[model samples]
Target: MSTIPLLASQLVVTTIFNSIESLGFSNIAGKVFSGEQAEARQEANLKVNTKKFYARGLKSLEQQDLYGAIKNFTATINLNPQFAPAYNDRGLARYKLGYKQSAIEDLTTAIELNPYRAKYYSNRGFMLTRLKDYTAAIADYNSALLLKPNLAQAYFNRGSIRLQMENSLAALADFEAAIRLDRDLAKAYFNRGVTRYKLREVQGAFEDFQKAAGLFKQQGRMDYYQDALAKLRQLCY
Candidate 1:
């Protein structure tokens, strides 16, 4: 997988974990009547096991064990079919495994299960963008931003698509918004530099490249650092 998609997958995983509190079985908590005690216990067990497998899936993903992550996430979904996060995470695993079409299908299911979650749309948008469906990808990003206006990654992703479409001015605006929301986003600075260069803003492009180079080096992204330095060299001449 390319760097952008890998970064987007990391963002998706982080977003899911951060929002985990909102993703659990909220209906599991009510008082159970005498006749329903057995059923309630089974349900509770299912929830516990589902969470256990889900956690394992996340651990596998963190360790870069893609197949293990997929297996665990599948177990999570089987235990709790309503668990949208499992499908979302499984999709990411599938994407990394090069099952792009299947990955999109899983992400679609996640969206169907929980349309209110902004990250699902954003995740799907990344997949669609990879498939070159720029229009649909843009629509997904638009939906994500509408649901969560402060989504810096969404802005950065949309800017990347815009840059690819050759809409340098609009791309510059999106990269600027992303940078405003997250100053540490090295890729946003790099893309904004590219956008500025396209627009003939030489000085602004040079500064963004320099910033991106420093950020990439600090973040231990030596390949990106080299690319940023190449941009600086191009600008100097």
Candidate 2:
């Protein structure tokens, strides 16, 4: 429910839509088959309907209509229960609606349906962190990293959790990894600055805060930019 996790959820939804669009489902009937033409046709129709409902769900999410998104995502799943993306997206909608346990369950089902997708694990990890299940959250983040080593968000989330646990050194490592993967990730720099400050690395912290402020300004995140500047001022003066 906090700003960072909410942003993560939004990013995940955007990634899900991008993945769906990139797949380019063209009529579903375009794939020719030799046998069971009638069955194939039915399946194709179902796929098309599933995609339509999924699109509606995504639109609802973009509109910040959590209930509508959940409804349409449920329709998408009803049409195709094996659709991993639908479950993942519905989990996010559920989280936005404060259905924490239900969101975790949906995300778990998504992972079960498609274990290779790193974002599902990352999404579940964020929810678990909200639930204060730090151990499970760390495991999920670890799994996400295993599936996609360059996932900056997973590293950032894990770093945040580690920082909460007062493991500043480990958190710093994760934040550094996140920044390595995504130099423009202002949050990562800000958090790493925090971790470095905690560890008495004052100069490093100052540099990171300065970089974070610059990136946040470039990204139009005025609130974060101001926050980073405040931290820099605190460090300097």
Candidate 3:
């Protein structure tokens, strides 16, 4: 279950990971995108007006000015209704502002506009999980995994939802998939350990917890290491 929360965080960043989209456009940008693409550009468009909307929005988010960031993203969305990235970016800002429902709407529109993009589904799934819509969230994650079969993050997310349902064995399978894809996934290790413990596989739990702590320490995530250590000492050790 704890693993589910961590997976949700990782999946939520899918939208932000490709955050640079629609950030650096200019009138000259049209030169590169000809025909319908060039003629489709909107006047007073945020993409052409300036990169400031995206940059400023990201900056405001980093500064904890969540409302300000949302405003900037709003400007972006108003300027480019068809801009999937703009919608996704706004969704992220909205999510941070605790506008979960609004974020879901924005992200949903984003996915509809850009159905081929895996990140959109991942982002939507992240929010759905928060909304406690586990079924929809897993469906979205599955959509992403369908496009990118080896996507460790998607596996991690699905594993989390399974964990929430107390399906530890299924959760463990997904965690193992994630680890096999990326051995450095500390979250997967910790989560798999928790799942193993719940399944009464004590020795396996101990090994996983120990490895998770070591991996967290290697990544300079001391809080994670400390937490894992406490759990290991109290339960696994």
| Global lDDT scores for all candidate models | 0.94, 0.94, 0.86
| Candidate order, TM-score descending | 1, 2, 3
TM-score between model 1 and native: 0.82
Residue 26 displacement (Å), model 1: 36
Candidate 2, residues 113-164, lDDT tens digits: the string is: 9999999999999999999999999999999999999999899999999999
What would the per-residue lDDT of candidate 3 be over residues 1-237, giving only the tens digit for each residue?
354455777767865655545454334446666655645765435467546676777788888888888888777667667878777878888898789998999999998898988889999999999889999999999999888888898899899999999998899999999999999999999999989989999889889999999999999999999989997997833
Clash number by candidate, in order: 0, 0, 0
Measured against the true structure, the TM-scores of the candidates, in listed sequence, are 0.82, 0.81, 0.76
- Cα-based lDDT at residue 53, candidate 3: 78
lDDT of 3 at 29: 47
RMSD of 2: 21.4
Cα TM-score of candidate 2: 0.81
Q: What is the model-wide C-alpha lDDT for candidate 3? A: 0.86
Candidate whose TM-score is highest: 1
Tens-digit lDDT string for candidate 1 (48-155)? 999999999999999999999999999999888999999999999999999999999999999999999999999999999999999999999999999999999999
Which residue pairs come into collision in candidate 3? none
Which residue runs of candidate 3 sit more than 4 Å off their true CA positions? 1-47, 50-52, 235-237
